[model samples]
Target: MEEAKGFVRRVLLLKFKAETAPNHVERLIKDYSNLVNLVESLKTWHMGKDANIKNLHEGFTHVVELTFEDDEGEAAYSAHPAHLEFHERAWPHVKKMVVIDYKPTSFHT
Candidate 1:
């Protein structure tokens, strides 16, 4: 059997105001998924849900994970027009953002 290789992961955390429209957020998520699908360098993508709990403050509402083969692949995706468009549309809705990039420690067996 052939072994599968693990790719570098890019994680994005975004915080939006409580007053932000849910429909707009949904639309932006859909648009982001579409853009990711069109990018050949993006091997995989996943979005996480809001971690809401009663009486406690959560810093972020959304989490996005993207895997790429290498830094070059990620760079290509960053420069893609579709991604640019998505950024333009989504930036206005965001209150704050955080990003982290790292490599997988172990490959799948």
Candidate 2:
């Protein structure tokens, strides 16, 4: 089979503490959306719930997927000030988080 090629996609699953306020989380989401908007190399960004309910252990309250054209693009995203700011503001409220990165084999929808 021919090898597929494209950007690196990062998947982030976050579970916030039960004591986290809804409004604060919503504000953080807005901040993230704004940060994504500023990144030119970020091809696409999507965030929401996981559709499958049966795998509750693997499920998270919020999921964020980000695509970058290459390793350099991803690196730039990692060092961006806005990204750092978002983490500083939101990390304290997060109870747990999981991150996975891979080259996308395909995309639908």
Winner by TM-score: 2
Across 27-103, the per-residue lDDT of candidate 2 in tens digits comes to 87778878768887787888986677587755368899898888889899888887888889889989899999888
> How high is the CA lDDT of each candidate model?
0.82, 0.81
Task: Please write out the lDDT profile of model 1 over residues 1-48, one tens digit for every residue.
Answer: 433354679899888766779898888888888866799999888998
List CA RMSD, all candidates: 4.0, 3.3
Q: Best candidate, lDDT-wise?
A: 1
C-alpha lDDT of residue 70 in model 1: 85
- The window of 10 residues in a row where model 1 has the poorest summed lDDT is 1-10
lDDT of 1 at 19: 71
RMSD of 1: 4.0
